[model samples]
Target: MLTIDITGAEVLGQQGFHRDGLSLSGGLIMDAPVGRAVDLTGFRVLPGIVDVHGDGFERHLAPRRGAMKQMAEGLVAAEAELAANGITTGVLAQFVSWEGGLRGMDFADQVFGAIRDTAGGLVTDLRPQLRFETHLLDDYAGLPARIAEWGVSYVVFNDHLPHARLAEGRKPPRLVGQALKAQRNPEVHFQMLLDLHARRAEVPAALDSLCATLADMGVQMGSHDDHTAEARAAWRARGVKVSEFPETLEAAEAADAAGDVVILGAPNLVRGGSHKGNVSALDVVSMGMADAVASDYHYPSPRRAALMLARSGVLDFAAAWALVSAGPARALGLRDRGVLQAGKRADLVALDAADRVAMTVSGGRVSYLSGDIAARLVA
Candidate 1:
């Protein structure tokens, strides 16, 4: 096993920063001497980020419509991006939804197969997370076995349908375009949507059953885009404890009060607010309601958001940084690799003066090394 000692950097300790730096050997932080020691002065060393939910890899996987040909290549590219962004453990949120195309069941199988095949070669710990659309009742029965086959331990429930308009008998905007993307006739797709909408009352019971089955399988589950406290409470009753990207403060407070983890998108923080005009992540963080932040659709946002939070003076570095590191790790039941302490996994990222990742080490193995940092290590 490779050993590396990173010195002359301000390492993040349990309370705050430590000026003495740290050492890594045999894939864990250690006090004993090891192999090479790289001088990383003028840098800040912290735990590698753990992204609990993110779909940014979709662009790399498909790039363009009807263009996906290789999953392994896409996964490799995604892993490189993750490592470059200081993410050691990334939960790739793959959709098993009604949107069809890349988000459909067939494509999800391909992604799962490719992920399993590429797992051994990946430097970052890439985990699969199923974003299941609640209205896909037919898919629910087979999900348990499918999840087990894919080695997926995390699942998030989503309902992206425009229920209000559909209930009013209004066709969804761009209905024809959506149907074409799903390879279905516009009329047929509209009927399908209407049929699902009519059966809305059945959804809760079905979701409860599905959640029960998933929980029995030892899968961690969360609900996405929670809009109300009542909706969040319903999901919570079914054992879906994580509230992902709640759109209202009441919803977020409900999750917090229930002791469920509240996850906001990192992009919301970096962009100053939600583009969809939902709740502000900054407000959630300030109120101490947000427990963690995911990269969501942007790979670079986690690091930038953490730093930005500190810059805004709303949170100290330790508290702000934990949203991307320790908080997310703990949310996903990963008790290791999110802290820069002895006896823990040696997964750390070093940021240069410009706040870019200068180096990233996952499991004491250098996953990303760039610019002057690479030269110093080589020398």
Candidate 2:
């Protein structure tokens, strides 16, 4: 193992003559003297990104309409892309919905199997996170065992059932179209929603039971796209502390006030807005409402988003970088990595001027480097 030292990088937004050298030995930072001999004159070293929610692999898995890559090939490709984007640790958000289709249980099984068979062996540490739709209660029983077997670190619950308020005045045609797009038969989906509403009182109890079960099985829970303080509070009460993609500023604020880590998508920050027409992540960061950001879909967004947030004066480099690095790592309960601190794992990335990943070091090994990775994989 190489004992390398990174010299002269500023530490986490602190100013004035703050130059430190990180020593890496045996794939982890070792306690050693900052030798004056090493030369790192102009480079800025940041921790390797820990992306808590990434769905880009879904695209790669089904690259085009009616096309799908083989599971192993997709996993390899995803790992390479993640390393190329400076993401050392990534949670692949497997969307498990009740409406059976591409994003449903069968797809989840393929993904979970791929992840289980090829986790630590991959270039980047790929973890599976089931993005469970709350209405998919029937799938919950099998999930706990899979989580335990695979060592899934995160679970996010999403309820995208059309709001009762929105449904009241909507035309049937429009509702049908929306339901079909969500991969549900229009009548079945509509009936399911109505049935769900009728059993609303039991919904929370069922969700809470599932949450407790998952927690008991040692999986961290997160709530996704929470739209209200009440919704946020309900999730927090269920011991789901990580709030993923709050749909409104108020919801994000509530999560922050409750001391829950608020995760926004890096794509939102990079694009300057939300794709779902939710709260602007830049605005959220400006208001100090977001604790972390993840590459929710696009793999490159996290690094670029961090730089964008820093350059736009929304946050300093350290604080912005934390959103992609330490913040997500901490949220996932990963203490071994995510910081350039003395005892952390030597998972680091070197970026070029455009904030593109030039090289990625995972666990003290050079896993990917600029053209080298793309060259090896693409051929």
As a whole number from 0 to 100, the lDDT of residue 355 in candidate 2 is: 54
Backbone atom clashes (below 3 Å) for every candidate = 0, 0
Q: Best candidate, lDDT-wise?
A: 1
Give candidate 1 regions above 4 Å deviation.
none
lDDT of 2 by residue, 27-103 (tens): 88777953333344444567899998999988667675347657777788888889988898988998887545557
**Backbone clash tally (model 1):** 0
lDDT agreement with native, every candidate: 0.90, 0.78
* Candidate 1 Cα deviation (angstroms), residue 121: 1.4
Task: Quote model 2's TM-score.
Answer: 0.86
Tell me how far candidate 1 lies from the true structure as C-alpha RMSD in angstroms. 1.2
